[model samples]
Target: MKHPSQNSSPSLDNVYRIYWLLVALFVGRMGDLYVLLSRRASTLRTYAGDTSLPGGKRDPQDHNIELTARREAFEEIGLPLDPQKVPLLCILEPFLAGNSLIVTPVVVLILDNTLRPILNTPEVTSLFSHPLISFLHSEPPFATEPEMLEMKYHTYDDVSSSTRPGKVRLHRFMTGRETGGTKPIFGLTAAILIRVATIGYARAPDFEVNAPGQPSQEQRIARALKHDPIFREAAALEGIDPGRIPEPSALRRQVRTRDKRRARSKL
Candidate 1:
């Protein structure tokens, strides 16, 4: 499986190369396309018991971001590392988490859906699956139980970002107990799927994917690389020059134009 360049421009390669953390969105079809998810072990210090994709920080032995994602998935959920069984789809742009970790989402298609999960009990408590396309809609893929009929499938709030200059949208998608477990998929997880679905289906979402004035993910990431101390330290360790990160305003304009073209093409 070939890993696509994380950035389009050669100059931004080093800037984007410092993605020390990654998550694997294991996409498979069991009728509707689905992505395997896991509940983080409650014993862990950060985001314990929260729902997340199978991934973790890059280890010294992992050769690249793709390998880092696959290795983490294998350790956390027993996902096969064989390229034949699972092949790379595409590497989405990096997202800066509230904790200051620049996480790259590595998407992979699972050719075999029958593979059982082998949970790393210390790192993951349980595993579940959610429809990939559901993230793009306001309703669940199937009929909901009477009690859960009142529950919303997707929602978000316009919130301020400490690292980025402007407001950002924090999305939340409910995956009910009967559907997958009690936890809702929000934050980075929700944002990732919205993008994956948009690409996979080649359709605009039923609702706006971003807030009115939210900065593009690229803009936010560029801001973090330039201004955040933790991101700066990670880049330095990677021998990356923060000076090479594109200006936030330039990225914002680029993203806006690209998004407009996408929206128009869909019409």
Candidate 2:
């Protein structure tokens, strides 16, 4: 209910110049449940890989930020939410991307899951939803400072609950890895988390990082490229050169086609 713009502290003014650039965000929440969509890169070559949310740059035709958020959600995730279904809560303060575009996130609530997502393979790979309560409960223990950024991580105390009563904790972390080093989920994701936490969600305490093991999701894809015969065959059929890294657009199309065929056969 708190507007992100109205809640901005004086300290944030030092880091970013507040521009009145209007970009909209759709915050789809069902009861205590919120919807967050994760996107996998069609290929490991794209800039934003394995990130969350359905959003993009604003279009000239958009009348307002709300429309832009709805349009992007439908285009990217195939979830066609009616404008009437999206209840406008409040506008968050605009955040700047590295590209210098000022992004305005518009928070909204979606009470039902009636619409099936027909993801735009060119951008999205998969869509999954988690309970808002879970997010409200799980705490990310560690934070990463990539290069020169001075981001801080904070811990939260427990709040009382009845259904699954326990203390809820939360920790903030950098989202992506650096260019020459390991990637972390920084940038947009970090910004979103910060906004959500500050807006109202109760923070959870931090936990220890899990032990490192096999190759990560991205690494697994890379390994498959080297060894998977199925991928090789698919690449050949598509007239794509396996030795050359495929463009994200081309790879996404192939994945979408494959997924569609699989879905039809199941039907």
Candidate 3:
């Protein structure tokens, strides 16, 4: 008997090709079960010590953003994500790194826990999984320099307003120190966490979620800007003033509103 979930008679002609090539954001559960990989050499750390989802830059060969994420996971952590195991849940804003690399994140649902992952020693030192709920726990603030950069956004006056107003936002990236002086997750990891928090909050019910000893998001961001090494490096690299980035909270709010509207449409 054919499984009902499998579309055996998939047709290309009926497929609607929406060329919406915007940066895609997604969320993935670390399988429903909690498991942690043994840490190899504690001394060797390159954003590989902590437990995290497997992901990386999108390769040019990927047919779509989803393919890019799946490929990277397989290569870095040795998890062969079956196509059937992943479902597209949401899209997030694009995150730009200091080096100008644009990242698109995709969230996936891991249906089973029996699959063992073979960690790539060169890329990943260990592998582990924790309940998504643990992310709510608070941790002490770590110290690091805050990063200042400019961000651009469009503002709409009203629902009926046709003209879109473009403005610059002063944005800040929190350093590892602000969290509790523990080794900070910065660069791509930090950016990924921001997107994850936004998506998680959107999907969660109205309730209070807190991290222990960690400062509020706003405060952490301020501290990051104060200690951001990139901001200083940029100044020396270009010999130009590394001013503060623009605040995109208004734009983020608009995006979240749009997400809610789309969610309503799905019902």
Candidate 4:
């Protein structure tokens, strides 16, 4: 069988750096596929009580991004670091977070859905999961949680860039606190899942995924490296040449072809 990592973009191999962080989308099949997630500890210093994936910044001792993701998962939720049990699916391209941290997503499939989670109280308060495909569709999965009087299930907000001219689309999906859910999954977390679902399912979202005029993912990253001193300094420290950033057109086409082939093969 072909490995999941084989489908990831080639450009990911060269972008590791200090400011780079990772989030593990621990996908599992429970009749339907679902993703494991945790709510940040309310007492933490930053982003307290926010919904997030199992991950953190890359440590100097961590040799690779995968290890960083596993280590963070183990620390925050007591998820074991055995690759045989939690094998990688793919590493999605990097995303520039609002905090200026470059976040990379590491998608892993949880082979054992029955494995119990041990939560680290200092970093994570509670753990819950949502249907993986629900990200692609705006409607809530269950009928138990009815919509709030005036609240929308999906919301799109345009965040204007301070360092550049274009705006980035911010997507928020209401989780509806069905049973074991926390707040709405929005911002970086929501955006990451949308991309992951698209890649995993080999289809476009039912709704428009990006803002009408937003730049492509690669273009945004390239612009950040060119115009933001913070990103430039990090790239310099990592010995990455800003001039070598790949254009979005080539990479986008490559991904589209790969997705088409996978669809044909029923992979």
Best by TM-score: 1
Candidate 4 per-residue C-alpha lDDT over 1-267 given as tens digits, one digit per residue, 9 for 90 to 100: 112244343222333332333344454545667787788988999889888887776654667778888888888888879988788788888887775567888888788666788999988998888787888886667554444646677788888877766788899987767345467888989999998888878888788887777877776766677656776665565557766765555566776888899999995
Off by over 4 Å in 3: 1-53, 137-191, 201-267
Model 3 residue 38 distance off true place after TM-score fit, in angstroms: 11
Clashes of 1: 0
What lDDT score is found at residue 69 in candidate 4?
Answer: 83
**Total clashing pairs in model 3:** 35
User: Candidate 4 deviates by what RMSD?
Assistant: 7.0
Task: Please provide TM-scores, in order, for all candidate models, with all chains considered together.
Answer: 0.81, 0.46, 0.43, 0.79
| Candidate 1 lDDT over residue span 141-222, tens digit each | 7667787777777788888855567777888887776354457888888888888889988998898878787776777878
Stretches of model 2 off by over 4 angstroms after superposition: 1-31, 44-46, 131-185, 202-267
- List where candidate 4 sits over 4 angstroms from the true fold: 1-30, 144-149, 178-181, 239-267
Residue-by-residue lDDT tens digits, candidate 2, 124-212: 66665533333333332324446424533323333332322122222233232333332343445444555554455655423422122
Question: In candidate 1, which residue pairs get closer than 3 Å at backbone N, Cα or C atoms, i.e. clash?
Answer: none
Q: Against the true structure, candidate 3 has what lDDT?
A: 0.40
Error at 178, model 1, angstroms:
7.3
Tell me how far the alpha carbon of residue 141 in candidate 1 is from the true structure, in angstroms, after superposition: 1.9
lDDT of each: 0.75, 0.47, 0.40, 0.73
Measured with C-alpha atoms, the lDDT of residue 259 in candidate 1 is 91
